[model samples]
Target: MKARPAFMLVGAAALTLAMGACSSSGGGTGATTPAAAPTTAAAPTAVTLTVWGPQEDQVDSTSWLPKQEAAFEAAHPEYKITWKNAVVSEGDAGKTVQQDPSAAADVYMFANDQLGTLVQAHAIGQLPPDAVAQVKQQNSDVMVTSVTGSDGNIYGVPYTANTWFLYYNSSKFTADDVKNLDSMLSKGKVAFPIDNSWYLASFYVGNGGTLFGPKGTDETAGIAFTGTQASDVTKYLTGLVKNKNFVNDANGAGLAGLQNGTIDAYFSGSWDAANVKKALGANEGAAQPPSYTLNGSPVQMKAFAGSKAVAFNPNAKNPQAAAKFAAFLGSTAAQQAHYDMRGIIPSDKSLASSASITADPVAVAQMNTVANASTLQPTVAKMGNFWDPTASFGKALLSGDITAANAADKTAAWNTALNS
Candidate 1:
C-alpha cells in the first residue's frame, strides 16, 4: 500500500500528562505517605467533523469506515468524528448541496462523474497544493484526471477505479472462449444489462462514438449517436437481442441470474464481483469484456470508467479538519481496509496491484479494464443527456425497432435526444 503521509499532529500537552506515581500506602506499615499531586494536561479543543457514504459503511461497526474515523481521531487528538448516514451519491451532491450547503456532509464519497457539478455549485473545495501533489503521486493518471476541474484544480482524492469487464464461469469457458462476445452468447446465457445507459455508452464508444469530445468538457460538441458507427453497433445489438442466449438483466437481474445459475457469464464492475464469485465458486473467472463482430470486423466493447472520490465540502464547519480527514479516508491503509471489509476495488496503484487485489478476479478485471481498455465517463452536465438516449437506443434495439428502413428515424430521434 502507498504510504499516506497525513498532517503533522501536535500533542505536547497529552504527552506531558504521563507523570509517574508513588506508593500512597507505604506498604501497609501504618506510615501515611503523602500522595503526589495529580498533574492534568490542558485539554485540546474539540472539533467535530461530519462524514457521509453508503449505508454499509456508515452502519457496520466492523466496517473500515469506523476504523478510519477512530484512527483519524487518534492522529488528530483535537478533532472528533461524527458520521451521518446519507444516500447522497456523487451525482446527487451538486444539486442537493446547492440547495443547502450547510446540511452537506463535511467529507463525502462521490462518483467522479459529478465533480464538474460539485465544482460548479461550489459544493466542494479545492485540495491544498501538498494534498494535490500526493494524490497525483499516489494514484493513476486516469484517476487524477477525473477529479481535476476544468480550471485545472484538484478537487478530491479518488478511492476506487470503477469500471466493468467480462466475468465467466471458468469451468465452462476457456481463456480463448472468453475473448469474443459472439462465442460467449453461443454457449448459453450471458447477463448484459442492455437497458442501462452506463453500459450502453460502451457500445457507442467502442464503435468510435465520442461523448462531449475527448476531455468531456466540450458541451457544444454534443455526443455521437446517429452515425454509421452507431448503426453498426445498434444493428449488432439488434441481432443479439433475438438470440436465445441473450438475457436483459437490468436493475440487477443480470447479477441475480448469474448467482442463480441461470446465466453463465456477467458483464459488470467490481461492486458485484464478490457475490458473483460466490455464485461461481472455483469456476469464477474474469477478464475484459469480449469484442463483437461489426461489419466483418471485431469491435472492442468499451465501458464507462469512473471512480469514487472523497470531496471536502466548501461549507464545512471545520474545513481544516475535513481536509485532514479526507486525506486519511483516501490513504492507502483506508483503501486496503475498504477492500478487506467491503471488497471495494482500490484506486491507489500500490493497493491496486497488491496480492490481495491481484489474486481476486474482480479487482484484476477492473485493473486490467481501466489500464488497457475503458472510456472515461464524461464529467460535464451535458453528460446527463447521453444516458437516457443510449438506454432508449438499447431498448429500441432489443425490441427490434431499428431495422434498415427504420434505422434512420430511430437514429434521428436518438440524435435529437442527444442534442437536447
Candidate 2:
C-alpha cells in the first residue's frame, strides 16, 4: 500500500470554551473534594469503522493496514475505534461498492481511474475542506486531478501515483541519447509495448491527439485522434514498426529481452523497478518518456497518469469518522510510513527531496513523469469505452494492417469508433 491517510484538526477555540465551562462549574466555592476529579472529562466517543484494501497490506499482524489503523487510533484519542478490515484490491473497489454502497467499507482504497464510476454509483464521498487542502498541499497538480470527480470536486486523497516512464541500459547509450526515441533506436535495441492500448497512445498523444478535451475532463469532447497531426503520427509509427532495432513488446517480451541482453531499453512504471535492476545491474537507468521526431520536429511522448487513493463511503454509518480516517491514510506522514514499510513510493511532494526517495531512480522517474511528461488519465465514465478500440488499432498497426497507404483511413476510423 502506497497510500496512507491523514487527519489534522484544530480545536483551540473549543479548548478555550471547554476550560471556561470547567472553571464556571467549580463556582469559585473551592470544593476540596475536587468534584469527583472532573468526572473523567466524559469518555471518548466510540466508533466502528470498516476498512477495505488488498490482502497484501493485511496478510499479517505486522502489515501496513494493521499498523496504520493502530496509528490512527493512537492519534485520535477522541474516539475508541473498533476496526473491521476486509480484503479488497483498489482496482476492484468501484465495482464492489457499486454492488452495495450501504455495505461497503467505511474507508477503502481505490484506483483514481474508478473515481467516475464510484461517483456515479454515489459510493465515494467528497473530501472535506481540510482534507481537500491537505491533498492539494501534498500532491502534484496531475495527482490532484486524478482524484477529482467530473463535478470539479476533489473526491479522494492520493498516496501514490501511477504512470510509466522509460527504462534503459545506461551502458549502451548516453543520457542525452536516451532523451529521444530516434536517438535511442539509432544506438541500441529498444522494446516498446506498442500492442498494448495503455502504452500505444503515447505516440499519437506526443504529436497532438487529445483524449476527452485538452485536460481530459470533457466527456463530450471525445478522443481527438483524427486530422493530419494524428495521421502523421500513425504514418511515423508505420515506419517505426519496420525499423530493425524496434521490437514490439508483447506478453512480457520486453522485460525478458532485457534480461537476455536482446533489448537495451523499455517503457514501464515503478512496478518493474526491481526486475529492471536485476536485469541490468549496474547499467540500469530510468527517465521520463522521451521525444520522438515527427515531421522533422521533436514531440514529447506522454503517458497516462493516475493514482491509488483512499476514499470514504458516503453511506457509512460513521460518515465523519470514516472521512477523517480516509484523509489520514493519505497524509504525508502516513505516505512516508507506507513507503518505509512496503517500498511503495509516496505521492507527497514534501518527500520528493528526502534521501530515500531521491536515492531511488524509479521513484524519481515516476514522479518526474507525472509532473512533466504525463496527462491525467481521465476519470470520466466515458473513458471506459476507450480501451478496446485503441487496443485493436494498435494490433492492426503491428500486424501490417495499418500502413502509410491506409494510416489516414485507419486513424479516422479509430477516432470514429472511439466517439461511437
Global lDDT scores for all candidate models: 0.77, 0.89
lDDT of 1: 0.77
Clashes (backbone N, CA, C under 3 Å), per candidate, total 0, 8
Q: Find the candidate with the highest TM-score and give its number.
A: 2
Q: Give the runs in model 1 whose Cα sits over 4 Å from its true position.
A: 1-47, 58-62, 73-96, 250-253, 404-409
Tens digits of lDDT, candidate 2, 91-181: 9998999999999899999998888889989999999999999999998888988898888999999999899999999999888998899
Per-prediction TM-score: 0.78, 0.87
* Per-residue accuracy of model 1 over 1-420 as CA lDDT, tens digit each: 333234311233333332222223445444334434445555665676777777678666667778898887788777545555565665566677767767888888888877877887888989988779879987766778888888889999988887889888887788888888888887868878888888877777888888777755577788866667776666677777888988887778777877888888888777676787689889898998778878888888888787888988978887888887888899888889888888878788777668888788778778778766687787777777777777777888777777766776677778788888
What lDDT score is found at residue 270 in candidate 2?
A: 87
Could you tell me how far off, in angstroms, the CA of residue 38 lies in candidate 1 after the best superposition?
24
Candidate 2 shows a clash count of: 8
Return the lDDT, model 1, position 135: 90
lDDT of 2 at 93: 92
